[model samples]
Target: MSKFGFLKVAAAIPHVRIADCDYNARQITGLIRKGADRGARIILFPELSVTAYTCGDLIQQPTLLNAAEQALGYILSETSQLPVVGIVGMPITYGNALYNCAVVFAEGRIRGVVPKTYIPNYAEFYEARCFMSGEEIGFATIRMCGQETDFGRNILFNLDGVKFGVEICEDMWVPAAPSVNQAVDGAQVLFNLSASPEVIGKHNYLLSLVKSQSARTQSAYVYCSAGYGESSTDLVFAGNGIIVEGGQILQRSERFSLEEQLVVADIDTERLITSRRRTTTFAPHRPNERIIVEISLPKNPADTTLDRWIDPQPFVPGSPEEMEECGNEIVNIQTMGLAQRLEHTNCKKVVLGVSGGLDSTLALMIAVRTFDRLGLNRKGIIAVTMPGFGTSNRTYRNALALMRCLGVTSREISIRKACEQHFADIGLDPTTQSSAYENAQARERTQILMDLANLEGGLVLGTGDLSELALGWATYNGDQMSMYGLNASLPKTLIRVLMRWMAERCKDDAIRQILIDVVETPISPELLPTEEGKEFGQQTEKIIGPYELHDFFLYHFIHNGYSPAKILFVAQKAFNDRYDRGTILRWMRLFFQRFFSQQFKRSTMPDGPKVGIISLSPRGDWRMPSDANADTWMREIDRLIEEEK
Candidate 1:
């Protein structure tokens, strides 16, 4: 959602003073104003924050209770100026019972009130002495600013097309959360108001819980918890405010700060709809009990400027440590997968073409690692270097050096002579060649690898990557076909970065120097002739745009099923300083065009390990229809591009 989505929500943690209703209301009102100014359609506050969570025993007093009710009325009235929906926690009296509730307000009026169902009676929470559990109640109408207000969680706020519901403190940590029942009743956004006291090493646990719940429910969750103003008499509160979409916490505030915190994140309602449609498990609620409250919604503006933060690196997670761990996991997944395949085939060697490029370099490294794990000789791995029409002297020399440094058997074959023989047999001119010109060289290289593997009784490892496979960029039945694909799930951007990282960490000087140079080298298919003064031949970025941008596009497109319009919208935001809208849209169109047209290629991809949540492995993550038309997708891009101009 950080990169691309339609829903914009914010969790605003305002500084509060214990038992001071007036001061807390003013702070909450300021946060609401700032959120509305930033284009947040929905805002949530902490639980029972009208008088502060640290006002523990003071909550039993009649004076504090009356002040809290008055402050609630004032907030509902003052918040009508902003075009947003806000949820604030307080105590409410219903049927001679005081219950903790989150009062939802919008446009200067009370819209709904959701009572907390499970009140904590254990530990230091003496809620059983002051309040009662939520009793069975229908969607009753209450007066707010002379209009009927909906009261209950059965209330779904339908703004434009986004439907949202609310949950109070302690609601989420329960066995069966109130949000689950609300989701079953068609709540797209689950707003939780919490005041959990912070403890040693509990913030990370809370983060995992929030993220996993959002993922499990396929909903946008905005959690606003009490910050520094709570009672320090017995516990401490970190102004914890987080916004999560799907399974990832897009943003979080600093811990244990005495200041107000605000986190804004976008949730793609359109993409969420697609997920629900494809999930097969998401459906309408058939719960034991539910309240039906259809509240009035704000109008959808024509040009809503979603002022949400977008991550620079979408595939990589946040924090340096997390990213390193993730990299290790993906590499292990790849190596282990290849090891099993080799064991099943009972092959003592793996044959692969080493071009000193990212894909081939990664494949070779994996082959060496796999052989070492099985206690096989390094010389048992046969590394073939095929110099073709576009093979630069730099790349050719690096390939040989890498093999020698790794202590693996190496061979150099000139594809120029082999392809000249192929062209003569097929009655084609060496000068007037077409696709037949390019593919002939590719097929010859593949033939050499396969034949060499047969001679050594080894598996032919495929070096074609995920990006190549996705765009049908590889030569069919040539480089695209392999017994075991070690690099199929790795994207081009990640491939280069990972190679650079490996180069930085490798103890072998020869391999490290080659990897570093290859990372700096221009990415090419090497199909065209390097006849004249060209430094690098047939660069892929010249046609496909930057791999960095395309990898971003791929993550948003397939991972979330985002539409072309949305993808373009997010791309502009994510690369605003780096790439202009025109270039981004141009690549976006190519992405949709190539992705849809290339399904046939992915449908027959070689077996590879699914390294991440998003992959195009037909045997595992991705299953696509080869006949999917690109017309609608193309038209969407065309229309969006024209509209932006």
Candidate 2:
């Protein structure tokens, strides 16, 4: 494992020759050495790989079984010097019964053996005819290749401090998989040696199965299957190798390739361990008589780089199809939440403020949809564009255009006079761009919306997003207070994506163009005074760092419980081309500082729908104290900054 708790593992598919143990041994050994060279600590091979799974009835011959054992022995001796734990499938016999087993070996020693618990007798499977089920066999010791090792279905191999379990082809397809028990017994990784034949639509289903099992167990799952060179008399073996962690596919091998394949991935064991701990239902069950064999692997150099894809925009979907689906779902969620709130209150009117920004534009769109969904007139949904001291002509024009095209009741409410009068009453100069000056404008606009909601018997729709809430960008009791927050769980980065998607689906060219411009506009609160010939006086990212970076930090820190240092490590890799380590650390410090200081605002935040996995709903997902200290978090970041210097 690296300093970040990443365990590099590989799933290998070696070219095979049916019943030719010596040739298969050479192929497996070469792949093992290659995996070791690539820094893989654990390498897995397909089921019955020593002698190809298609050996059929020849599997019953004593000569073939002995040859398989000799092949395993040769592989062990050949790769004994490498710092990798190799698991290979072969037939093992004891007490006059043959069992399909996964033999674990490292440093020239057979650590342990785990047998297949479930035997398939269904279509295209006749494993029950040759091998006895090892489910009833509790725990025992067996001699194989001149070494005595624990042998049973209840055996786990411990390399260094990490424990992993193994299962065979049929064991994984059954309802009661041994991996579940192994996970409960504190196994962090699971391996499966499979030789599943490919059929129509089976590959997709198999991928889903592996993903679900890894998610269910909260463990890193490494699966390898027999590929080319397996006899294809009635079935074809499309070599399928997959490495999954916590329901996400990290890497997969190309299927039906004639050459031997090795697919490697770095599994975040720290994330898996943290996930299991957070999930209350993932508890230990009835104890089983399991044996854990401790194998010491040679120490390797620590890895300085990650070989996995780290998404810079975790909230935004990577693919276009997924973006379309997720965008529609988020819109539906926001629209439905507002619709339900409107129905519960029996109010057909909703009062919202539109600044031609991403958040407000999205909220306005949802309100229009809600009114349409309820068969109410669009005029009932009032969209107020309150021009303040910092309002820009570009945004002002776009706001009016969008409200007009959407056919909502557009109102222009100027807060300049109101804020100036309040400034005079408070005996303060409005010329100074202080916190009070900026916040007074926000409070006055909120007060106007509140009174209008009362006059029209409507609800004040809030536009504050998750990213703003995390940074405490909203003034307390100003824009933060709402009847119901539709975009509370949505982040700024995602709001832009959703608006773009909505623009593409829009039939009105005018409204679509306005939406597109709104997405391109820089994000800001428009609280300061605007100068002539300027788009806006203030930019949010300039002050709070990029929303993309904050969203990435938020997901890892809150959703994955990553430390500030670890978040920096991954963030550096994710945004390496755009940002350096120093810039990320600088902004990360600000994130932690604001996140801790702004708890009081979130503590009293209004009710909002939780749309995603990461939420700051104090009453639901997150419940941090209003006065939590950021000293420890800051110290870690400070140390990293010092290292950079």
Candidate 3:
């Protein structure tokens, strides 16, 4: 069996009645069993679930407190047979004061108790009137329901592989939440048992709160609130529940549901841990006042089936409006970054090779915008098109037309003669189409661009994108070397969108038509000889898998650090009816091999602004040894191949 890095967790909103301890306990116990059966290792209930949050002054009654304790004991006994670890909210009396608390229990035993740090006393809330803050008690040992439990604000439960901390309602609403301390104390997940009443527009605020806290703490946060059966005399309890991991909300419950609701999600604990490890800004361990309770989970296999949303295009938005907005923002970022670079360098002109392809076209457009932003003349942007053996008429015409229409200094330099001479000098035949033949053209074009920049007192702009860098598709020291690269951070999949967006915004009809044709043209190096006519026969996508699949693989592999099995599984679901499993796996294996081999190209890459999370810039987002072995990864891929067969 494959070891899963996910922990199946659930937030349960059980039906509650005010001060009805027995009924609430039954509801709680039943949910525990259901969650356990569904493979939830950790299940959390709403705040003050034993006696509903709306109990009001009845919380002061000794008889009601005693009944709550008895009902809790009944729940513990009933759940002893299950393997689920639970956090149940109640009010516990220690010394001469009562503190609202969440008790952690597993295998029929109370592991520890955590008190509410902040008690809300504002409108519609009077918690401060009836409960003492957990901060007041610090740490204590309290005997209750025939067992002595470690009680206080300083308590954490680390069981098997999941270490989590507990807080209550208003604790999350206050600044500097206990969850921050809990995360600093090595809590991978934070559970908030809440009884917050729903007001107008509070759900959106609460949802943002949970997401921000999870992002800030770099931990998974599960929140559950009191439900419909609670006393609605003053405020309505709609039972809002949420589960978030790494700033992304995985699941949220429907509000105002009368039935018992359980929101379950599989949180990737490995991914969270990896994020913390990668980020050096996270605080080290502090002196903890909480007791650490260690528990052993059952021997059942972990659930490998994920229940979270795995976006097919993690870098691109699915909505058309959002796509346009994202495209505009990305172009702005690229242009602004280039503009700043140019101003800092005090360069007189900008020179770049324009292939009339997506990447080069985007780079050319950015150069124009940068010079325009700096109030420089359009002639300062030198756009060069080097037509080689396989150059198609369509792309060559588009490149020349775009340059003329954009009012830049256009230059046409054919690399066929230079490449033939270089190939002959190297004792290679120019008639044979090979890597040498192709790379010769690329190197010759680069040399011409570099020389032109030097003569013009400008900088040579690189057009290789992130996707190409990931797959090592650029020729080393040929197209890979540049003074400054504007498209280094943009992926191939997104570059097409930016091209179309630029066309849409173009004022001149000729320039717009040229940009549209460039977007429609097939991506290729145009270094090999065409078949009979000037049509493009060396299409890049046919050689490398589709950009969509490669980009998807790159995002999940580098950004999310997902395993091959998980990536393959999600790709099957995301690209269902489009690409079969065999095709995805074949391309995935190729991706891993080339990615490992291509580190040399990215290791010495030029300076470029990082526009996204998955930049291959060695100085910024990624740094890997060029010689690192991929045997371990290949073994996993082999296993997947066998399974698919």
Candidate 4:
């Protein structure tokens, strides 16, 4: 593994000539060289690659078997000088039984050989006719091609601190495959040498299996299947190469290609280790009486680029279909949570403060949906628009337009008079636009919402989102305090996506247009005085860095438990196109500072439904001390800045 915990691996599908050991061995050697050139520490090949999986009954002949062994010896000799491990499938004879096995070799020496556990005797497969199952064959020694090595079904090879195990084609299809035991025995990566023929819809099912298996084992799975040049008498082999880590496919080879294919990707073993450590239920089972073979390879260069996708908007879904499904589910969750709350409280009304911002807009929509679901009158869902000093005309108009279009009971309550009175009572100059002046408006708005809810027997719905809570941007005892916060678990980046999705599906054109305008409006608390003719006086992103970056940091830091340095490393890659290194560093420092300093606000945050994987609920998902220090995190960022200089 690299210093960053990344191990570069490759899945190679070489074009082969059936039963022609010489041609197949040359092809395998060439692919290994190519994979090594691309910085792959371990290169894997398909099952029976030495003589080709299509060599039907030729496996029973001693001449063919000896030729296959000779071919493997040739491959080992050719690629021995290269500092990379190569795993190829061939038929091995031991004690009057031929076993279809994966031979692992590195630095011109045989590391180990893992036999296929499950022999398939199904309709399309007849492997049981020639080879015996290696399930009962525990740790044993085997001699092949003038090299003695450990041979069994329970063998794990370790190269530079990365432990990987291998299984054959049919072994992975069974429920009790050897990989489970291998993983339980502390294997961080798994490899499958497969020759399964392709049929209609089989590729999709195979892809799903790869994804699910990697996810289930919480390890990197590299699978290589036989491809072009295999005998096509009954079934065709479309070289399928897939590399997955933690259920996500890092790379997949193009199927049905006639050329030799090699899919290379860097696996993050450290991330997998971290995940396993976090999960309590990933219990250790009956450990394999495993044999470990260690091989040391040269360390990867420090300047090596990562070969994985780093999502910029980790909170938002990746694809359009995923976005649609997730958006619908999120809205349903919000509405159902609110609906249940209202029903439990026996309240037919909800008082919400709408500022035409993303958070309030989303909360108002949820309230309307909840009221509709509960069969309550829309007028009872009071949406109060409190225009404060920072309230811009665009947002004010959009708020009114949305309320009018949605047919909610809209009330325009100006907080100017209330805030002025409060400032005078507190003996503060009204002209001084301090935090007190800003927080006073927020407090006054909350007071109106609270008083109105009490008079109407309703709940004060909060509009403060996860981002605001993370940054402590909301006012204490003001916007931060509500009877129920609808968007507490929802982040700002996701709010934009959900709003856009709702707008596209909205039936009413006017309501849809209003929602669109609200989504496009700049995010602000509207607590400061607005400049003349301006839509927003203070931009939230300008004050506290971009929500996209913050959400990314929050996801990795809290959900993935990544340190500040690793988070910054990935963040620079994720947002390299939009943000420079210095810009990302600047905001990342603020994120840690604000995230640690603002825990007091989050500690006392109002009750809200946990919608996503990352939540700051003191009662549920996240619980942190209010006085946790961030000096260590800050020092890391400071060191990074110093290194940059």
**Residue pairs clashing, model 1:** 6-268, 7-267, 54-231, 80-107, 80-108, 227-239
For candidate 1, what is the TM-score?
0.93
Highest lDDT against the true fold, candidate: 2
Residue-wise lDDT of candidate 1 within 399-424, one digit each (tens)?
89889989999998888987888899
- Go through the candidates in order and give the C-alpha RMSD of each one to the true structure: 2.8, 1.2, 2.6, 1.5
Mind sharing the TM-score for model 2?
A: 0.98
C-alpha lDDT (0 to 100) for residue 13 of candidate 3: 96
TM-score of each: 0.93, 0.98, 0.93, 0.97
Residues 328-425, candidate 3, lDDT per residue (tens digit)? 78878888888888888899699999888889888888888888888999899999999988888888888888898889999999887777778889
Q: Name the runs in model 1 displaced over 4 angstroms.
A: 1-5, 135-155, 282-289, 299-304
Instruction: Please list all clashing residue pairs in model 4, or write none if there are none.
Output: none
Stretches of candidate 4 exceeding 4 Å from the true structure: 284-286, 301-303
Model 1, position 478: C-alpha lDDT score: 86
Locate the minimum summed-lDDT window of 10 residues in model 2. Answer: 298-307
lDDT of 1: 0.80
> Candidate 2 — which residues are off by over 4 angstroms?
none
The 0-to-1 C-alpha lDDT of every candidate, in the order given, reads 0.80, 0.90, 0.88, 0.89
Worst 10 residues of 1 by lDDT: 294-303
